[model samples]
Target: MTGNTHIVGGIAASLAYAQFTNHDPIIMLAAGVVGALLPDICHTGSKIGRKLPLLAKLVNKLFGHRTFTHSLLFLVMMAAILNAFMPFEAVTAGILVGMVSHYLLDMATKNGIKLLFPIKLTVRLPITTKTGSKVETIVFSALTLLSFYFGYEAFRFYL
Candidate 1:
């Protein structure tokens, strides 16, 4: 998935979380951004990956793509750890929303993510859409529109 998609997913997920939990919109947005980029830390080409290339390389070497990082187990463990050390509601909400966005965005690609990694069961949607293709272009455009709408809504709420 592209960075724009991640940002859109983050915004949408954050907005949804805010609506559900009634937490501060800023906090939920922050969490959503973190969640959306967290999973891609394992991929060298991801946004966060460029910031921490060595760590990304290490993760890639150790686990490879769509294996450990993309698994439900990884998300659960992350949530558990965050819940233990951080504020339960905010952290858990952020992580879950982010992971969900990541999973959904990846699913939009031609080579879908290994959602149930380590189980060797690949779950891909029937629709085939390559990243940066026409489908992706349309999807990203829609996401951008949604993000802008959500951002406007959030601003209105806060202001």
Candidate 2:
């Protein structure tokens, strides 16, 4: 999936989580966007990668795209790191949700991801689409609608 799709998925997932947990939606949304872009740091051509070229190159060289950075091991490490350094539970929760959303969106792509990492197993849904394809645009649109719904639900108290 493209970065924009991942972003929409992150927003949708984060808003849903905020609504369910009654956390601060604003913080969750911000963290979600950050987490959504984290995995693609392994791809130098990615949005995040472009911003941090040196780090992106190192990560890309060390693990390659859709390998360690997209794996469960990376998620676990992130969870641990966030737990230790992050003072806000909402931020941690949002980031994790966004990261999960990232991989879930990627799972819909033709290339898929190495969800299990060291095991070298590729994981994806039965139905997959090429990145940036018409189907992906449809998925992006659907996710955008979902984000709007979740956002409305999460912020209804303020409405």
lDDT of each: 0.78, 0.93
The numbered model that scores best in TM-score is 2
TM-scores of all candidate predictions against the true structure:
0.90, 0.98
lDDT of 1 at 137: 80
| Model 1 pairs in collision | none
Per-residue CA lDDT of model 1 for 1-159, tens digit only, reads 777678778878777767667677777778888888888888899888899999999999998886778778888888888888886577668767877888788776777777777788766678868777888788778877876777677678556
Best by lDDT: 2
Worst 10 residues of 2 by lDDT: 14-23
TM-score for candidate 2, please give it. 0.98
Q: Where does candidate 2 stray beyond 4 Å?
A: none
